[model samples]
Target: MPEHSRQALSDYAVAHTTKPDSIFDDIARDAQTTPSAGMMSGRTVGYFLNTLVAITGAQRVLEIGTFVGYSALMMATALPEDGELITLDVSEEFTSIARKHWARHPDGHKIKLILGPATETLDTLEPQFDVVFIDADKDNYPEYYEKSLNLLSPKGIIVVDNVFQGGRVLQQDVPDDQRSASTRAVQRLNEIVQNDERVNNVMITERDGLLLIRRRDAHLA
Candidate 1:
């Protein structure tokens, strides 16, 4: 095919692929807004999360960050009638909007939203989960991963979003500040996962990035 036509075809392919209804899109319809627009996870990442939920037949799911509940809604939609999802977020403002859309879905009742800082909220949970999704504060990536490991059952999956930190992980000259701290923390978590013996891992470059970790016995690895 010609160069321009080939480029056009590729663009079309990308656009025509399955796209999840994002919270941002919902906001556009409702004329609602948030500081970040809750545009964290992309369509590809959302679909991946949904597929994982369906594959594992996850009965219980824990989400660290419930930004507008986009990911939670996507996951809840895939859960069995009796399955449940516990989503935590500090932002009551955003969660309120998320609740609005979530309420519209028949399966929305499966989602239980907890408001408060995620770390504090997670501390109160029992050790029972089929899957846990970490997408909260980047600086706490390691903490979230460690906590999720304890919370997850054997064979359960722990999916971490934005592990790439917008490609800042590969950059040089990070200043000594919170931004630098978050970047450094994410780097440390990546190293931890790379050497972790308890989980099989794959880091995919979808949306920002996604780290899919499956907890299994050493023999299974």
Candidate 2:
């Protein structure tokens, strides 16, 4: 499929699905004017995250990236009134924008922002998250996955973003560079999940790629 065609289909899908409210629209508009606009999860993926939280009745959610808090806001809305979402990011600048938007929503209070290196922050979290969404640095995906799995509840799910690494994962030869290193890390993480007997996993191609993993025992039960 051509890039334009794929994007058209994506746009059509978002148009037909349940639309996000004005608060979300406002955040998206603000994100578009920023240098890191592409980092936003957009409508399609945001809805998917919301649906996952709803289906799981996830009371405690852990988000690894929290870029502009778009995904966190969507998930936070899906949570029960007493639910909580802990989001970790390294940038104060990006999260400051997120905090502004979060303050507009009633459920915004459910979102907890922690600014620091995620690798260090991951260790400080309690092992109680019902859903874990990892969308942080690609090079640290393996470490994030390992820590996230330990933090998850027995019946929890882990959603990994950017698995396709901007289509580099499918290429036969990649130049040796920092980007290639990130691509290799994503590929290695996919392989690790594929071979792990403890979990059942599936990869879906959307904006980027999403790898959804669930504990094998929970999946079978």
The CA lDDT of each predicted structure is 0.80, 0.92
lDDT of 2 by residue, 108-210 (tens): 9999999999999999988889999999899999999999999989899999999998888886465556357788899889999999998999999987999
For model 2, state the Cα shift of residue 206 in Å.
1.5
The C-alpha stretches of model 1 lying farther than 4 A from their native spots are: 1-16, 19-24, 27-32, 172-179, 218-221
Q: Can you list the residue pairs that collide in candidate 2?
A: none
Q: Residues 168-215, candidate 1, lDDT per residue (tens digit)?
A: 877556665645787898888988998998878999865567888877
Error of 1 at 119 (Å): 1.3
* Native-to-model Cα distance after best TM-score fit, residue 5 in candidate 1, in Å: 15
